[model samples]
Target: MVIHQNFLPLASSGLPVGKIYLGYLFIRPVHNPETPFKMDVSFIKHWKKRTTLEVGHRGMGNSYTKCAVARENSIHSLNKASERGADYVEFDVQLTKDKIPVIFHDFHVMVSVAKRSPEKDVHQIAVKDLKLDQLRLLHLDHVQHHSNTPLNEQVIKVTGENDEAEDLRPFPTLIEALQNVSTDVGFNVEIKFPMVQEDGINECENYFEHNEFLDRILKDVFLHGGKRRIVFSSFDPDICTMVATKQNKYPVLFLCCGANTRHQVYQDERTRTSLTAVNFAAGCGILGVNFHSEDVLRDHSPITKAKQLGLISFVWGDELNDKTNVEFMKKTVGVDGVIYDRIGETELRSSVFMLEKAKKNELFSKKIPSPVQTPRAGSVHFLNDQPKIPGLNLSQSVNQPHHEWPISSSSRRRSPTVTTEAEKYFAASHGLIQLNQGYLPQQLTTAREV
Candidate 1:
């Protein structure tokens, strides 16, 4: 499948601090992972480029809304993501009883009240049921009810009163987050709309009408975003459609739970599978689908299908915490972007890839051996599985770069090669190799094998 993208820049150079820009994208039908591949159908047209964008999930990091220092979705957490050089700081935005949008994660948060009698009563209150002032006066020290931990164990509040400890602050309004976060960093606004009941019962109460909810938030973003790059997303297909149709100022991304989505109470038919999301987003003229990592890794046909339809693709899940999983997403699955918890660590690992590229470049400049010349740009190759190493195969080359030579743990043998300055550095760095003039380094010999 041929995948392409036209990057619609949010602003000339930097984010418009109080404004948002939305663009259009298309998606094609994705088949099962095990299905045979087929040609892609024509979709939308714009520009065609492939680049990986990084988004920080719920600020720099979160342990299920319990970040180590800053409260998840708080202003402090958002700022930390920006400081760590994330292209976008993603957070959940929900409404209060007064129709105000606040940066919060869960639908129902535990509320605690301590009275003069030293007796405290706790209740699991839906965020939409409380006025902004009432919500503000109550500290956000409780966990989501889905945590399964007892209510008593969930109320551990940040007790210190330091400026950096802004986790102690009450939940922040959407306007506050927009006004305070850095102008250069973008925002991935995940709108938290409640789901429907399985038995056809109305699951939510005291909530603003869908149109009103969308309108209020759009007005706030227009007034405060100031050309900021805003990518609106939601789990609800209807909400995604509303955002896509209501305005053209920002892109809409459909967030899918996919096959391995855990702890879900109810499932919407439109978003039951990644394939459904691909079709739904395309029909709605939405830009992309942010799938869970399990969905993509299990069967990357969706990524291919999305690309064929001229749609942008993104992945987010706990699996992204491992750098290996992240590399696989970028190198093998070929996603447009990934949202992970450890933004700093992921970015650092990405830099290591750059370092490897630099090393390859240095080797090429020094006229390294023929078996391992720098593979063409945007091309990835793997070492042949044969017992004997074979030279490069120009015919097998593809657009993905770096034909990797993995040292298999089961293989205790080494391939011999002529030594150069690059080999000398490799030997010195690993301390397993001994370099000699015009001779293969010890690191390249069998002596270093386990």
Candidate 2:
């Protein structure tokens, strides 16, 4: 079991406080004990003070409803989002018939077939039924209500002509995306699981087993994720549960329709409302909740409630397309992240993560001053004239005698190892220690002053 201690600032409420108060501690039990890997989740959780992260939905934007530069979930779209300054890009991932995870939004694709008639006939087929090779060969089009009618439209092209480049083509594998997309950009992978809609209809029938499906995708991510920031989200509560328990490497977010009038709600009770979603996420030790825009706009109390529970909140939906709504969510509601379409359409901005990284580099790159001479013999002085590193306790080092400083046994055999105050500050700030074992006490006791 992993116990996460979340410290929140309490100065705003006018209460007597130290630097920070222990807001809450949540326990996440390991369901798959055999899985040995664990990940640091501080990057996603510790973003309240920074600017709200902007994520490009389905990479630049969903191509079905709105006109997009490239096909949704294509490599072209993902790179476009990275170039446009999105902190993270959200895309849908589902397995093909051969269990190859591919990036696609819908469960079915429209394929054009030529027959005796002069016009080509269109047929709708589930993406899971087709192999990877067959799916790539077929000229795909958007699924239509009238399948009998002959329409020669291609899904990738905005205009009437089929002039899309290879990168703009759909059905790119999950591995392909991990390899080709910008390493600086993060990825919000939405697991495509079949769910029961509000109207007693299944989104897709006879899908792969939940465990097998999730395992396949997780394997691909673990093998190729490297240092990229990644988060897994799903509307299905079961999928979210499995994702959280199966591996501790990535954070899982419960996607909620959240009492919205815009779209049909799923039959699952957890996804029916944002409040219930928060309750479920908190109870399950899940990282956060991604609320639909319609519900939060109507009553933003859910976001406040999420923050109170120490759960990160992100807003998504078609309503986020409007720049005004995006600002309201970011400034007024104070969401951790926002997923929208047509990123950089109004204005281009650098990622908040990248900006913070640059600042850290600039701050650390400045040369440190040499140790100053002390009045007394066998004494050393530091930081008297140098800029102080944040979170570093310099007083302890300055007051202690040079010979009395704690040194590791290995240092005694060789030259004395110097653990700089800046190194300690950076280690603690970046969560270099193991998270599942608890960090605060361990970092304090183990990090000795040199």
Candidate 3:
């Protein structure tokens, strides 16, 4: 997007109004005494169209974020992500004082000060200084459901079955998240703290009494395991080691960051540059690595080398600063995923994928001369084409998506029905993800039913 600005005065107010030239469109400012505002945006030349990775940032990216949606860790947000075409979602979970594993991100809750001490105003008091119960009464300013509104307002107004759906949102337990997630999408679960003391933060008394919290999370994860892929991550080496050793089924990812970040990783860990932080994770015999994208670019190096070592790489950052960065990571660096702030963005990119998928399905129908079944993007159909149905028009129109698609795929959709001289023909589910469930219109068929 390239933007050019021009200013004009309002006849009513004599204030300078602005008009922005963005490509062919003229954009005007929104209610700010400005005539028109222009923002010229363009992506990096090196980074073009790339596959948009599925991601979940906390729950709903709304007001109360401390994993407090009664169903915050509920299946709703996860299902919402699914609707948005997310391939996977990220969440933070940790242990509570009761040794129960809970899904929460921040270390403290923001509470208003207790009623004035009968003297001076107590408004200056910090929320963290208050006890858990005191904080409980006070609502979070940032609710996952509504952005930065008062939690009390959201709670009073929210209409759901449980408190999780209510406003003062208590954190979701680990069992709660495990039960809620989609079996198909992958999970990027960041363990809130470590099992043992690194220096002082993860001491047994502070974080958990025993490793029972870890055990409980892993147990629930394994017991109800479905098609969902699991990736466990933590800044604590002890926790990383435990996940690697104790859980044999899922993949373990080591999370590393700088001082201001949630957890710290030693500088010695940057051995694999081309492959990025994924190399360090592989070195530890874990599955992958999640690094700050700021570290990815600011380091001024490539991580492709690390990829050769079989390390899965991912970046978390404001990659959306420009869509070009998204292309750079996927096309040039070949990262496994990029987590970001907006879930709606993922949908725009997915539409491109669906369009390409449609084209590929058409190409597939050409090579196989069988039932001539064509499944719609995001849908599946059992077709029995007839003279009444008429053959599909090959050149009706090109299905173009609003967004750009990622790298070209190596595989193509296979024909669902196969008929041969020697073998009998049958049907199978098309391999497209999120296959729709419905029937072709009655006007579409006179052929035999399956």
Candidate 4:
């Protein structure tokens, strides 16, 4: 025995329906299927499986198609990622010559100038070589895909150029960028290091020694903790080691790049496989490895290997960094998190975490399970090939248009004119509104006045 929700206005004559939800009515079949109980579907809708984990790499990520947005490390990108329902945002951080840490991608940045500073124009300049105020004079040049940037903007660019330093892209200090973001999103900061140093004794000279650099950034991160968040990472084992040892429990990740990547090879190499990288990180007390996706497509065996070794895994880059690839990684590859350039693409990934959080919250609540017969009358259950109860499970699906139900020839012939109070009631409801075409609400004049 089952009951319908109060909202449904059942014809109440020939039908033996259990409940009527939006576009759906659960009806008891003339021939019951099991235990003298059976239900028939009145609606068909698409159902989602479960939530996915979404992450933002270097911020919202680059716009692969459009040139409108290209900066992955900029504040605009981070905010865009937040709007896309990302659980966290990832970027890079490095210490400058003056010992100030800033959010940037590479050890060296390209600045374009038509005439000024021609000696070192359009070349990769070490971030430490420039002071904060001087760095602010350049604008971003490689914002995904674009051209030369103005100095006033000071935005970091990633475009390849051969121009002299007349007008260059400006790079931002980490503190300056953090001042403008929200605390809700987590930050994965990877420290950029050069292949080799200039001096032996001053090997730690221009660069803030690992510990000094880590602490200074930590101070800045905590100061903005009320409005921003921070997690540290680096490709250099020493850098991650320095940070993790200082705080024993703060989140830290080890970044792994392919041996032959960046068009160059490291003089002092770490390992051939990223799985070994994660193992190395664990040995150093680092949290986990942020792996490149090329590792996944080539053979995702390392991911499982990392898991077996008891380390958290996060996938990054164009391979597993996109929407489809991330989904595949979670559904097939089974990583704890994913890092990407676009928040929209990663929304599904973040959903995984959201759903888990929601299910956990339900455990603490005192409630009775609903019966399977009616949605509101009982607990929620998934019955195959049937209509769903409205407002029961609000999956985060977009407004996907569906085809209208086709009318059979017999039903079409029997169609009657709308003569019921239903049409009149809608007309009366419209009449109550003081409608306006543009902005202001207008008062309607009576028919007599017209």
lDDT values for all models: 0.65, 0.75, 0.47, 0.53
State model 2's lDDT.
Answer: 0.75
Q: Which structure among the candidates has the greatest TM-score?
A: 2
* TM-score for candidate 2: 0.71
Cα error of candidate 4 at position 399, Å: 72
Clashes of 4: 35
Q: How much does candidate 3 score in TM-score?
A: 0.52
What's the distance in Å from true for residue 362, model 2? 1.6
lDDT, residue 244, model 1: 60
TM-score order, best first, reads 2, 1, 4, 3
Better of 1 and 3 by TM-score: 1
Could you give candidate 4's per-residue lDDT for residues 1-450 as a string of tens digits?
344532223321222223445533332212211213222331111112233346777676653233324455667676667666777777777776677877666566656666655343455466788776666655534322234554334444453244633122224556656665555565667777543411212122345444455667766665555433355777666556555544432467777764424323333345346766866766765567777777666777777877677667777777754457877888888887787665675234343445556778897675879765642211112111135444432122212221111123442211122244543343243332212211111245799744
Off by over 4 Å in 3: 1-52, 62-75, 110-113, 116-170, 194-205, 258-279, 300-302, 346-450
Q: Write the per-residue lDDT of candidate 2 for residues 51-121, one digit (tens) a residue.
A: 78999999999887678777788999999999999999999999999999999888987777789989777
How high is each candidate's TM-score? 0.63, 0.71, 0.52, 0.55
Pairs that clash in candidate 2? none
Clashes of each: 23, 0, 35, 35
Ten contiguous residues minimizing lDDT sum, candidate 3 = 8-17
- 2 or 3, which is superior by TM-score? 2
lDDT of 3: 0.47
